[model samples]
Target: MPTSTSTSTSTSTSTALLRLRRQLLSTAYGNMDFRYQLLASLADRALAELDRHSSPEAEELADSHLRPEYIGITEGRALSEAGSLGIDTSGWEERRERIRSYTRGADAVTPDGTPADSAQRLWASLFDNYPSVAAALADLLTGLPPSWRMDLFQTNDLTQVPAEPRQQGDNGPETAPYSSTDWEDCAACMEANDLCRFHSGFLAGEQHLRGLLATLATDSIALEQLQDRNHEIGQRQARESAEKSPERETSQ
Candidate 1:
C-alpha cells in the first residue's frame, strides 16, 4: 500500500511539474523578456548544481587562475586549446596584448567616476572586438535548457524571422553584424551592440532583453505602489467609518 502511494505521489509531482513547465513556456513563447527570465533562472539553477559538484581542490585551482599573478594565463590556456584543435594561433598573442592595453584600469574609471557602480571593461572589450569569444563564453556559461531550443522570433517559416536593427560602433570590427544565416553567425556579430535580437548576439541580446525586463519590473513596482495606495485609502475610510459609527448610533 505504501509503495503504491509513493508511486502515485511521484506521478502526481511529475505531472504537476510538466504542466507548470508548459504554462511557463507558453507565456514565454512570443514574449522575449519572459523567455530571458526563464532561461536565466534555469541557467542559475544549473550553475548552482554544477558548483556543488566542485571539489575544494578543483575550486582552489580555479581560484588560483583568477589571481593577479596569472594575468596572461587565460590567453595562454586559450592558445593551448587552439593548438590542440589545429587552429592557427598566429596573431593571438599580439591581439591579447592589445586587449590588455585597452582593458588596463578600464574598471577603475567610469566617465562619471562612479566606482561603486562600474561597467565590466574587460568584458566590454572582448564583446566589442571579438564577438565569437563572447558567444563561446555564453555557450560555456548557460547553453540554454532543452525547452528553449525553439526559435525565439519566427512565424510559420523559421527562416523568415526578422533580425533586430543594427547599432554600429566607431570601429567597423567592433560593430556586431546581423547574422541572416543562424544563431551561431548572429552571436558572432553581437560585439556589444544591444540592438541585435539574434540568439547568437548573446551578450547584446541579453542586454536588450534585460532592458525590457527592467521596464516590466518597473511596471510591477507601479502595480505594487497602486495596490499599496488603495490599501491606505481603504484603511483611512475604515477608520473614518469607525469614528462616525458611535455618533450615528447615539443620535439614533
Candidate 2:
C-alpha cells in the first residue's frame, strides 16, 4: 500500500481550518497557537458531522457523557484525544458509559455530575486541568515552524494556491500560444505571449483579502484574551494555595 500525505477538508469549515493552520504556521515559534487551531478545527469537524447526521448508537455515545462524575472524565478524554492526541485516554472507554447516560438525557435535571456545560467546557478542562490536553497540544506543535501559530489576533498571510486559466484561442485574440495551431489564422506574436509564463496574470480577490484581515483581527483579540486569562490562572492558583496552606504563603 502507498503511504498518503494530503491535507484537505470535505467541508467549508474544514477549508477555514486549513487556511487557519496555514496562516498561523506561517510565523515563527507558533506551536501553542498551531495546536489550538488544529484542535479547534477537529472539534468543529466533529460538531458539524454530529449536527448533520448520526446513528442511534452514536447518539447514545454522545449521551453517555453527561454524568457529573463522568463529565470530568469523558470530556477530558475527548479533549486530550483531539487537541492532545490519544495520550490520556487511560480510562476513556469506561468514561463513555457516563457520557451515554448524559446523551440519553438521564442526568438532565439531577445535576450531580460535572456534565459538559458546552463543548468549550470540555476543551477548557482538558487543556487547563487534564494533564494530556497541554501535552497533546505540545506534541502536535512539536517540530513545526513558528509561523504555524497564526490566530485572528496575529497576521494571516496567504500562500500560493496552484491554478491555471483555460483559454479558447490559440493565436487569435484570446488563445494561448500552445494552441496556435488550433487558432487557424491567429498571429504568432499573440501565440508567443500565451506561451510565456511571465505574461500569466496571477489571480486573487481583494474582498477575500479584506475578509481574511477581519478574521485575523478577531482571532488576535481572542488569542490575547486567552493569554491574559492563562496568566491570571497561574496567579489565581498561587493565591488559592497561599490561603489553603499557610506554610506556602509568600511574604507579600
Candidate 3:
C-alpha cells in the first residue's frame, strides 16, 4: 500500500481508497449513477424554462433523468493498494515527487525492467480510493467499514451548462453541453446510422449500453440506409468536384 507520513492525512487517504476498493465490485453501477446525475443536472435547466411553455421532448428529457438504477461492482481484488500522498502542512506543485513515491505502484517493476503491468495494477488501486467504488464492493466477499460514506463525482459541466433555461431555443441541443442522455435519442440515431456499434459490444448488455441500443434501434435515424445514402452523397460530392475541376486532373 502507499504510505502517508502525515498520520492525520492517512485517514483521508484510507477513506478515499476504501471508496475505490468498493468499486472493485461496482463499476457498472458507478457509471450508471454518474450518467443519471448528469441527466438530472440537465433537467434542472429545462425545469427553469417555465415562462417559455415547455418542450414535449424536454418533459421526456426530465422524466428520463429521474429514472435510476444502481452501479454494479468492478469485480476482483486489488493485489496492491494506495493512499493519499500526504502533503506537508504546506501544499506546493514540486512536492508531487514525494507523493509519487508513496503510490501503490511506486516500486512495481518487471524483470525486464519495465513497470507496465505494475502501472496498470496501480490504476485499479487508485480507483478503489473512491467511496462509490467501495460501495459497489460492499456486498462482495470483501471487508468494508460499517459507516462508509458514499463518494460521488461533482463536475461544473454537470449542471454548469451555459444554456441556462432562459438561454435555450432552436440554437438546437448544442446550446446545452448535455448530460449523456440529454441528446441521447439524437446521438443514438446518429450512431446507429453511422454503424459504430455492430462491431460487437464488449460490455454491451449493461444498462447504459442497453439504453443506447434501445434508442438507436427504436428512434435513431435509419443508420444502414443512411450509410448507403452517405456513400451516395460522398460519390455525388466526388463527381461534382470532378466535373468542376479546371483540368481533366488525370484519370489517375
Candidate 4:
C-alpha cells in the first residue's frame, strides 16, 4: 500500500495540474482582453497627440504606437506565461499570428457595429471555426472569481444576458442537486483520501463559473444551446428523482 505521504503528494500533484489547466485557459482569455486594452490605450494616445499637432513627427509617433509589433509583444508575454505552466504553445503560434493579422487589418467588429478588439474578434472567429475551444474558454471563465474576472477588455460587446433566477426552492433559491453531490463528494474525498486535496470551497467557486458562462452567451443561438443543455440536465434529474421516490408518486 502507498504511504499516506506519497498519496498526499500524488493528490497535490493532481490538484496542481488541474489548477494549472484552468490558469492557462484563464490567462489566454485575459491576455486577449489585455491586448485589446493595450491597443486602445495606444490609439487614445495617438489621437490625443494627433489633435495636439498635425506635424509629420506627430503622425509618425502615432503610427509607431499602433504597430503590430506592440501587439506581438503583449501576446509573447502571454505565451511565455503559458509555457511556464508546461503548456506547449508552439503549435498555437499560427493561430496567434492569424489573430494578430486580423486585428492589424482592422475588419473585426462587435455586434453593435463598434470596432472589435483583438480578443473579441479572436473569440468570434474561434466560435465559428473551433467551437470546442470557445466552449472550453466559456467553461474556464465561468469559474473565475468576480475580483479575478478579466476586465481589461470590453465584455459589453458580448450579447448581454440578464441575470436569470437559478432554479429556486421555497426558501428562495437553490442550486442544482448535482452541485450538492459534487460539493459533498469533494469534501468527502478530501477527508477520506489523503491524496485528494480539493478545495473546501470548490462548490462556491462554481457559482462564479456559472455567472461567467451566462455572460458569454452573447447571441440567441448560444443562449438557446445553453438553455437546451440545462433543460436536458433538468429532465435527467427529474427522472432520477422520480425513480428514487416511486412510492411517493404512486401515493399522489
RMSD each, Å: 24.4, 31.6, 27.0, 25.2
Quick one: ranking by lDDT, best first?
Answer: 1, 4, 2, 3
Residue 132 lDDT in candidate 3: 58
- Candidate 4 global lDDT: 0.47
Most TM-score-accurate candidate: 1
Worst 10 residues of 3 by lDDT: 168-177
Tens digits of per-residue lDDT for model 4, 20-112: 333444554454333344455564455444434443344355345455675345766888889999998877888756544533432333222
Q: Mark the regions of model 2 whose C-alpha exceeds 4 Å error after superposition.
A: 1-41, 50-55, 74-252
RMSD of 4: 25.2
Candidate 1 Cα misplacement greater than 4 A, ranges: 1-51, 71-76, 85-177, 180-184, 187-192, 195-252
Off by over 4 Å in 4: 1-73, 100-108, 114-252
- Write model 1 residue lDDT over 1-252, tens digit each, in one string: 644543453345434333333443555554444335567457434433433454233334434544578745576687888999999989877876654565444525433433222235435656766778878887865876544435444344444655334333311232334566554324323332222344435656777988877876779876687679999999999999999999999999
TM-scores, one per candidate: 0.25, 0.18, 0.20, 0.18
The collision pairs in model 1 are 176-189, 187-200, 187-201
TM-score, predicted candidate 4 vs. hidden true structure: 0.18
Clash count of each predicted structure? 3, 32, 28, 3
Better of 1 and 3 by TM-score: 1
lDDT of 2 by residue, 126-170 (tens): 443355765786687685767663542245442232223434422
For model 3, how does the per-residue alpha-carbon lDDT over 1-252 read when each residue is reduced to its tens digit?
112222332234433322332332244334333334455445344443521343344334434434453233221211111113442324333444433433334234322322344334333433433445545654452454433232222332323333234321111111111124343322221222211131112224565777866776876475566678999999999999988785655643
Cα lDDT listed for each candidate: 0.52, 0.42, 0.37, 0.47
